[model samples]
Target: MEPHVWPLYGLRITTPRLELRLPDLDTLSDLAAVAAAGVHDEDEMPFSVPWTDGTPGERGRSTFQHLLGTVAAWTPGAWTLSLAVRSEGEVVGRQDVGANDFAVTREAVTGSWLGQTYQGRGIGTEMRAAVLHLAFEGLGARYVTSAAMTDNARSLRVSEKLGYHPDGLEVLSVRGEARTFRRLRLDRAGWEAHRTVPVELHGLEPTLALFGL
Candidate 1:
């Protein structure tokens, strides 16, 4: 079946140097290429899913399929907005903001990755801030959460910079072994109190219900 298009077409979040948007086919392909070029080394797994564990082509294909699947599986109670991040008009990475039963929970989750070439340039932080702006400001979310392997310091730092507090920890088996992760949470008040980026969101009202809001 063809995926349902979000009611909020051209929904955009922009910072001074970057733009984040739900991508069309052309842009999605660009995003796939970014994944193929490498976000991290094959021997190193930064995500819980090990989505990048295969060959380079497989990694790219998985990214493309996952983004498309989110659109195909969208519903009022759950949704995933896998947005392409553009810098100076070129696709640089992906940023995702999503919710499960948002109306009842008023919560969402954020995830992202930047091309290795783009790391250390503040793009990850900026992109994350853009999504936080959308979650709390545009969608009226009360809380946001995320998780990372305990050893992933860079990710933990980003969460800290954005005002998320360490909520707790969990142990989940991955790749045939037990892995411990740190869970983080940020309430709206905390987000507003620590926000430092200036972000503008467009075309969100019509898509609010897609997140069960």
Candidate 2:
């Protein structure tokens, strides 16, 4: 991508085993195919939006449109960095870190999903470490927040592994019934204490202004 026109596309975050970047159209299509194959079973939803409930085609379209929309609608005051997670050479998942009035609040929220076949490995944990590295060390964010359904043990485990303290819980309607969720938070000090992975930021200098840095 042309950095002058869309500098966010030039941003990259990497861990020892993973590389995250804004996917070009062709790579986005590949990521969409991963979504189309399936992200979870028909029974449970780890996400609040229920984006994976439909047919494979519908899920793929939702993934593509949601990501593209975030890029189109971004502004420095409020934006979502939705980067495609790459392992080895394959597009495996998506990770997001977003904020509103970030320059003032110095806070951001994280969200993500992985294809079903890729779930059991430690990729979710490593990719998350990459973005948290971007938020605190790269962007000078003071805090990051995330939530997971109470029944979603894997997501909770990832948060726990990353040194996020359980802030509290909330109830929400999902699919149909009420669901309880665990809210987690990590401050810069906490992240520094428990961060276990080595992460690197590249192409970040040119994108600082876009993040209100």
Candidate 3:
């Protein structure tokens, strides 16, 4: 019998020290454990959505469910490629590259989180570069966008380093409190010119249509 494969079964994005790919059940469980350990400190909430606001076990369960939902709800016009980020063959975090109305917009959004233990290193930047490569080169995306809380200097800096231009701001309610977020965007030319990491993608042909490419 043939091995069960997902729409993006064998897709992968690799950097010098990291690998990003769709997580299988076992890998997803490992990813959940990492998330359960925690991402940010208890007092802080970096994401607009408080997905990690619950208990550690709850966070892990939520991570697992969210990833599964993305796959089950996928459509040609909308998709969320939630790839597990691994370092040295161990699940460390998650990097999500997503799109809406991609067939018409040709635009994508990127979001990610690293385990607290992995925060200060340059891993976040490198992982993002891999996804950017997959977006513009592998998926033929025309533009990519991202957002960071106004206070999230690390995230904003990563976007700046990748040549994403400031696209103004938006206010959103986070945990019942209103907060300002800085929006950023990068075009194909800008991404190509600023991209430095050499990324390799494997087995994306069968899933290209699912992303409306």
Clashes of each: 0, 0, 0
- Per-residue lDDT over 1-213 for candidate 1, one digit per residue giving the tens place of the 0 to 100 score: 122455644588999999998888888889999999999866777788888777779988998999999988988888888999999999999999888888898899999999998998989999999999999999888999999999989999999999999999999888878889999999988899889989999877776667776
lDDT tens digits, residues 1-213, model 2? 677789878888888889999999999999999999999888788878899988999998998999999998999999999999999988999999999999999999999999888999999999999999999999999999999998899999999999999999999888987889999999999999998999999999999999988
Instruction: Give the top-scoring candidate (TM-score).
Output: 2
lDDT of 1 at 70: 91
Ranking by TM-score: 2, 3, 1
Q: Is candidate 2 or candidate 3 better by lDDT?
A: 2
Which TM-score value belongs to model 2? 0.98
Worst 10 residues of 1 by lDDT: 1-10
Winner of 2 and 3 under TM-score: 2
Model 2: lDDT to the true structure: 0.93
Model 2 CA lDDT for position 132:
97
Give all TM-scores, in the order shown: 0.95, 0.98, 0.96
lDDT of 3: 0.91
